[model samples]
Target: MLTRLDLMAGAFRAGAALALSEPEIRGLGRLVRQGDVCFDIGAAYGMYTYPLAALVGPGGQVHSFEPLPNPFRLLAAGRRASGAERIRVNNAALGPAPGRELMTLPYRFGLPIHGWAHLRTGQRRPGRPISFSSTRTLKVEVRGVDEYCEDHGIDRVAFMKVDVEGFEARVLEGAARTIDSHRPSLLLEIEDRHLDKYGMTSADLADPLRERGYLMYAWHRGRWARVNSVTTARRNYLFAAQGGL
Candidate 1:
């Protein structure tokens, strides 16, 4: 009863689900129950959102924010196909505060390609002119984690995943209140090269979380690695709040 295209789509979805459902990643999902809320920043194609929605079940909610149009469309389509009604999709970028800013794209991929000018050194591919496109950027509301919880009546957050390109610092800044209050475990992506473009170093990215009582661990070789030096090209670091204060 299924066409070839249907079978292919099913296979693709299955593979995607597996890649995003790794143990370390699913650990966050397991933290969310039937009524908790989770936020997914830069949710490219809802790779993690669908599984998260399943973890949260019918009662919990997942708010996914994507700034770029290409991936945002795919995220929305995936949510629909998965019947993830508890997931709310927002088409805007989150920053330190709420304001419209220029977002640059040099690559077709969903991740941050070329926003930081300093990191632009020698990375540009030859013979490819940087493409410039602008959308009506919206200053979506910004809230610290604590404030967001207070506003939404969220007493506790099971998990928070942040992957805001080169703007992870700003995202963390805005969520300081939440981090300080609820102490929700955080899964963040850190790229040294990307941060270097904004005059930021790896310490600048990790230090704050350390100060906030979060322990840093990297994902590598199908497990969480405690040392960042052990990570590979596909590895990402996870920060777990040690003690809620």
Candidate 2:
């Protein structure tokens, strides 16, 4: 059983793993260009969102989405300070369909952990380490990437950063059309420990992009190395279509 501190460390490691290094910034520069549209799905406090916003510039647009209310408020408020006027923050989660889903919020000192709130899959292992507060739940609105793009008249998305805990599969599942047609490069966080709650493997998350003619790569020591197989060795993966890469 993991303690609350252990869970916090896990969350910290997850963030550190997702952050782009100097070379990674350069590598992503090619895929994420100025004046191009981008998305930061599962954006918590705009970590990836602000970076995407910076790369896209004023001419480009970065759409950021966070389901939890606490993070959503922070994300929206940061827009003014970020002054990356092209960014639009939304308080909704992107899933396979449009509906409402209850998210079980993790807690530390009785406050909701910013990024630990995940969709209630009910598969949470019984007698799991730290107890999650049942009352600390929020029903978040869910939308599909395909529908959101269509509704917004967005034609081409330059890149997307998806780190929705274990729900990456469903998000991409809804994005099949978008990935097929627009061919945007993707940065994803895939961890089986989290995915297992939803009965998914890392391969299941990467397969969607693979089927769309995308290749996976891992950032190591300031260089991008092509990954031949899908594994959890690297928590963050860059999936790019040939056209974008």
Candidate 3:
């Protein structure tokens, strides 16, 4: 007999499988390896965590960070259900330093709020505030990747996936040392509205990686789409350090 949560988890997994094309999944699979150290920043409900854990195998390790209470609990539950020893769950938001910050979650599934606020074109409204969860500011711990790896004795990080709402720039700033030292591949989400909220643009995100000798390519329609900063929303960009070790 399975619990309702288990059923929901199963449904979520199934939906993800159906939603994501095979090539996209394969591309994500290719970014990691056995015994490698991977980071899933802003891991919402373990959508990528579980699959990544399995991809990395028992020898590799995954550190998933999520700050929101609801999603954090879901990530913990997913980790437990996965029974994968290599996945370590952390409840925190990664930024340039360790401190407290406020995060605004969506009131509805597709209703964008905060910096990333934008109307979901072609999507029907789910309803009013009653149909959506209330928005609140919660204090969350923020840390740099370099500090985290140094303290944990993780010498090399193979891949880092970041989806920190509108704070991607800050998150990247905090991981400068780590990026310089480990030269890990990065999978970053970039939304124009979100960047605008922080007074940044897609160019700001791409310029740094380009300066560091990283090659940028977008994930789109089940394949890697070579593109520039102007057209990033089709999918997240993948940055691999030139001559990565």
Candidate 4:
């Protein structure tokens, strides 16, 4: 009975509500408390950073990362505006090794793309239908999670969100020591299309987490629910360690 306009308006309202209170905060609010530490890889423009800072309070620390130069600048600006001294912003990408890479930044309709920028790891093939109209490149620093955390004296992590497009496996591999030691709950984005660019499958993501004693969860039917496996249909997933949430 709903027209297209009505449907769009409903979707907009839903997004507006989500913007006000992120589902991550609502779902994992109990898990992460005041004074806890958090990480936001692929933080983009601080959409999650600011809200996360609110939940953690001034006592907690939120270390956020953005690889793209433009987004990193914007994220850093938001960090400054927040004046939350504990919220640390890093303009580097976390990967298997600490190095530098020429990451490809895509632009659609003459605007810098927000969600689909990826590391130029291999022979740059024409992305399936090439979502962006044009592209630019930037050399960005890459750090390993365990190394970074150790160097920065970060001994505990209550939560982490990893949304580096299809580079989930590499990120996880780099953070294996950190995950094993801290056992923080993880929110990640891993899509087949993104993985396909690197010749990876969803199982490449799932099996590792399972081996490390993690169960996958997806936000389903308006609530957090367990999922048996990661699939292309569901890109964003929550991984809880040391039992269910």
Winning candidate number (lDDT) = 4
> Which prediction has more favorable lDDT, 3 or 4?
4
Where is model 1 poorest over a 10-residue stretch in terms of lDDT?
A: 114-123
Models, CA RMSD each: 6.6, 7.7, 6.8, 6.7
**Whole-model lDDT for model 1 versus the true structure?**
0.61
| 80-109: candidate 2 lDDT, tens digit per residue | 655556889999999888889888777776
Q: Count clashing pairs, candidate 2.
A: 0
**CA lDDT, candidate 2, residue 111:** 71
> RMSD of model 4, in Å?
6.7
Residue pairs in candidate 3 whose N, alpha carbon or C atoms collide under 3 angstroms: 35-60
Which wins on TM-score, candidate 1 or candidate 3?
A: 3
Candidate with better TM-score, 2 vs 3? 2
User: 40 in model 4: Cα distance from truth in Å?
Assistant: 0.1
The candidate, 1 or 4, that scores higher on lDDT is 4
Backbone clashes counted, model 3: 1
RMSD of 2: 7.7
| TM-score of model number 1 | 0.72
Candidate 3 Cα errors over 4 Å, as ranges: 1-17, 20-23, 106-134, 243-245
- For each candidate, the alpha-carbon lDDT, in order, equals 0.61, 0.76, 0.71, 0.78
- Tens digits of lDDT, candidate 4, 123-219: 2454546767898988999999999988999999888899887888888888989999999988888787787777787888887887889888887
Give every collision pair in model 4: none
The residue-level lDDT of candidate 2 at 109 comes to: 63
